[model samples]
Target: MKVLYKKILDLEIWHDYYLGQPNPPKPPPTGYDISDMLALVPTPECLRVLRNLRWLFRPQPRGASIFAHVEQASSGDFATLLPVNRPEQLTFWLIVRDRYFANFTNLPLTTNRHQIYYFSNLSLNQGHALFLTQPLPNYAANSEYHLGQLVHHDGKTLEALLYQASASKNPNANDWDILPNSQYVSELDRLPQQGLSRIYTIPKANPGDIWRLTLVNVHEQETFVLDVTTPITHTPGDAIACSLNFSGQIPGCYKLCLNNIQVDRFVLCDPIASKDAFALVEIVLNQSLVPSAFSLLQPQDGNTLIKPKTYVIRCKNRATRWRYRYEKPHGFSAASLPNFELIDAKTYATKRPLGLRLQPDSLLTDGKDQLLPAPAIALIKPETDTQAHVTTIFSDIHL
Candidate 1:
């Protein structure tokens, strides 16, 4: 529901079908925003379908982002069910920013028992439908299948019985089972505690070839090489599976590297942490970083005078980046301190704002704010050399 409406037509379309009504009676001036899907009021049998959709598309998990999720999805060609919304059998698509030219140009989507639609790979883009709201194509021999998938084969309908790499045949006699011909059940299944946590497909992967996968924690600065020795099996297309199992590990921002080159980055969080947004921090620097120190040009330790609302700290280094922090009245924890960056390298002076809390019994001239000089620290990283460094300089300035 947190959709961004960029044009007038977007607002109009939302107004017309916001109450779960069908599409607009007729085409509006904007033609048709095929990208914006208007949900329908669920029938009595499919009421839970709407609820599941809301849960799947809810705001990103804490410490994660939509872009990060998309990057993982687009890393390679894949088809997977939305993890939490499996009972509904809704298929999710994760397309790349640039159009992906799939090996199979035309793909079939089974929307219902009687409906099947064919779409071109060109129709896929970052803005495509998040969930197909339908099942994927019929079962193919030796193809990968996720849990709770509905598939129609030959004359009877079948569903996937196992998790990843499940039984490759129909469940009537193999992995999939036929559902009773009745109203759709709304019963929810408990969340899976164990299974393959994540899956990635490697396009153009040579059959029987192995690739090295490393999970690098952005915060802890730790790298763990996963045992990915299992040979990938090539099917229909050149795409192969690179399933990632991060079970029993701390959840944080992780970078997926293949053969030493960073391929994708994503955030992993527990169910509780997924409720709130976590600041997405990227430790990987795209450019060269070299730490360099600079001498304080102004406001030396003993140099104290009068300044109204702010004070300036001058430095001689022309750093590519600069950040600073000041001590608080109570005390200062370096880890908890927030950084304030100076954007321009030419500006040698960093202006520190003074925040004053006045008390009824305290006179303006006698207040602590006017009596003490704050301890400050400055950090800089220059691009002089290939080696990385963090140069820190400390000083005291009167306000």
Candidate 2:
């Protein structure tokens, strides 16, 4: 049968038979250091139970390890080996780094169901010190336990156990895992706050003109400084109007500022035309800047009338706005309105009639009734004081 022994003081289990023996009759000057041998033995079932209880009470996942298996002794009567001859030590020296456990003066010690045969007094201190042994079990190394079992303990609460485990475990674990909880606690500190600035773009004069410059504040908490490679030239007292055209698309609105001073607000209504959608009513000054050219269509106002019997029809420009217009008069007899020709100043300057037409209606009007005339054609100039006139004549009939 496998025999297990627990320490009477801490209820911690031990695999070494010598740990079960009662304390020697003679007392030593300093407390006994059994942490060294405890390192050789795997965690006792009682110790694992105590660790679980401590974890439950503290509600912390800091110190916890899963046991894969426990080692069992092969020799006869492993617990009768006495206080010194056992293969593993019983006492463990726990070192408290800070005042972590200062409040818990009288800590109740309990272990697994294993029977404890011997124990030493408990001592808590700031520096290195030894505590009494608590023998709980006796197990042979590499006997029944597998190699993957893990054990955990707070460095502050049990520094010696951590060190011993590190030394005994093949290829020691990381220092972080071996250190006490106090050593792992970090100081409460914060990071500095930061601020950012907005981004802006420089305006260009022409639609295709390229401006590679960009203004921004890279620093998280610094003011933005705008420096343009292409210096904007403005008239002595006139403010500059800056607008953005997105790749020949419609223009967008943006605030215009001169030397960090608010001057005027402008918006791009038509990207192709680049007309100012919104501008101050009062024109402070004529910037003398030529606006971009655009194509526009305006409708003519009045109708043209053709005199019956006469092949020629006269028409005039009646529209306030001038635009290119093409007129095609239909519903006419072939004979009444004869085919005519169109002429411009550049083409027929000497001729009395600037425009000609043909294909009048063949249908004749009654002598008493007023008849509709053929279509007249003419080109009118926009914004000009002169009016547009057209003259047409029938080929067969002379007027």
Candidate 3:
């Protein structure tokens, strides 16, 4: 049986992050010491769960982290959060970080489910912290999710954020299964002939326990016999891994399963999406983009795109605002318009998307780390509103 993570306690770890904000230079001390363990245990379930909790770790598809998977849990929020642990669902995660933890003292003595906490220091000059975790399913290790509110911009659509309850399942049996070694399932799914071969690290499940891959779109249809199957390795807790190779013929969404239980959803995106747009946009714009370049399809004046791609609208003369929308990908289902808010923006001397740019005479070098000369920037202003069509190219931005 997989151990589900729950019952966290009040914890404080010095941090340097915050919600919807940038990181502070010097972080403040969290009101706890190094020897504090948030009353946790070391177990197979805890180890896997810990992999999902990213503290002082890179944003997502989290790599090996400082949080050790030893059977014991840290005195902090090192435990990755599981979906079934919702408040009314027998497992709920309650986190009160930074100033909130320090200001509020009327917290429950023992939460019925679990808690992961981080309290801010008594000072305002120190860096605060943000809370993030992984989806307890098979996907890229970089896959991450946050449990807080995100600030947004205007002229975009808005959807009511609601929690739709899934059909109930026994916690002891039906839960998420994380496949550690998977990089991208879409790569294999993109082509019908280009077979996808990859490894999956199953933290639990017998090696012979009837593993199967079912095409989700072809649900209720006949099953294509497995073409190639190989057992790679197995660890304790009945954990095992396998190398699965299949004909890209079944190009669509799919679910890997144990017995009849679903594991995770994987999709094959259009292969053409792999083409680098920054280069194309740079060529079209004539000059090089500063820091980064963004390119996108046309959008309306008031509509907003839910996707993360930014728009560098170079209007005739500081146009007050710009708008964008998402078009359905070439072969995917038609997408409904979603609300978008400005996560970021930049201004530039928008110029004609033609003409060779004058090369720079000098490049700055970072003495310590970077040996490569810094990229030269071009700030040519736009000749007219004609430059509005040249900004925005981001896709496959998952939550």
Candidate 4:
């Protein structure tokens, strides 16, 4: 005789048989082992039918030890079972302890069916019949669900099985928008437009030194002259010149034309013998050219003291033509001298200073019988008790 038991979601199945009285446990039944029979009912339909079987009042009739097996479709394998039934109980708790059998599932056990079937192949194991219960739910997908089982034998003794499933794990998260912004405009737009004009130092002119003139356009745009001699020039590049013999010092003034349209007047100081003495000139233009109203002062002397041994004699303006004469010291007659380069006529209109070197062939002695060479002379007024007297000396000239 043999006994077999199986349980599903809502059903149960039990089989009872006789194995002739326990005659020295002849080799376990070869054709139909209870463990082999339990391996067949893992399908959903078999599990549902097994869950309905009644086993609450079945007594623990002792015979031979009963071996149990369970299989699951989701996990794809069969597992050994622990005897979890108490005295007089018809239900038993099945536990799978293998790690390989535990993790083999695509879906959780609660959602996937796990069929449990149990059986004994011999009547010798009749008193020790196996028990089966409902498939345990998979709480790994949602840990809140729990599964607990208790097996009762003959309605008195009990065995308990506990199962716990946890929730899926998580990682961490990140963020990125916490800083501020910065930026604005500048201040160079408020100034006036101005251009660079060349500086000119005047020259000292003796009786015959030539004068040259030049008009320079310092502005980017061309300016016109309206009336050359009336200070109303509207045309560009206009100029004029006059010749006067160097007699005793006289007040100097002149008028000119700029672009043949604008007239401008210039006043010059009396010619002096010292290098530092200078003349002033003013150029006035029409109302439209007021922004470039120009004025210049030029010296009539050509002496410049650069070093103790050197001196430079320069021409004043460019437009004026000139001749030169040299007289020997002792009452010798004056004669026109040659061998001088014609100065650039355009240089003087803009008031550029022109220079020439003076190197004496022999040292000349002064009135005091002291040897003096070609150099600059400085003029100064002496301080007296009540009035000042002027004094002149050659070493005091500034280049």
Instruction: State TM-scores per candidate.
Output: 0.22, 0.14, 0.22, 0.11
Off by over 4 Å in 3: 1-195, 218-236, 269-399
For residues 1-399, what per-residue lDDT tens digits would candidate 3 score against the true structure?
554433222222221111111123222233313222111122222333334542111111111112212122243222232221211100111222223221111122122221122111110111122211110122222222111101111311111111112312221111121111211111111212112554555666643345554433323332333322334453335656656554443333345554455655443222333111100000011012111222111122322111112111000111111122224322211121121233322211111111111222332222122222211111212112243321221111211
Q: Give the per-residue lDDT of model 4 (tens digit) for 1-399.
A: 334332211212221111221223222244322332111112222222223322111211121122223322233322212221211111122222222221121111221121111221110111121121111221132342111111222222111111223323321011111111100000110111111121222222233333333322212122222221312332233332343322321222223333332233222222222112111111111123322111111111221111101000111110111111123222221121122222222110111111111222444332234443333211211112222211110111111
Q: Candidate 4 lDDT (Cα, whole model)? A: 0.20
Cα lDDT of candidate 1 equals 0.29
Candidate 1 segments whose C-alpha is farther than 4 A from its true place? 1-196, 219-222, 229-237, 278-399
lDDT of 1 at 301: 29
lDDT over C-alpha atoms for residue 335 of model 2: 39
Task: Give the residue spans of candidate 2 off by over 4 A.
Answer: 1-250, 259-378, 381-399
Best by lDDT: 1
Candidates 2 and 4 compared by lDDT, better number: 2
Could you tell me how far off, in angstroms, the CA of residue 111 lies in candidate 1 after the best superposition? 27
Count residue pairs with overlapping backbones in model 2.
40
What lDDT tens digits, residue by residue, belong to model 1 across residues 54-125? 222221111111110111123232112122211121111121111211110111111122111211111111
Candidate 2 local lDDT, 76-140, one digit each (tens): 21221122111111111122222312111111112222111111221111122121222112222
Q: Each prediction's Cα RMSD? A: 30.0, 50.5, 26.8, 63.4
lDDT of 3: 0.23
Error of 3 at 362 (Å): 40
Residue 365, candidate 2: C-alpha displacement in angstroms: 13
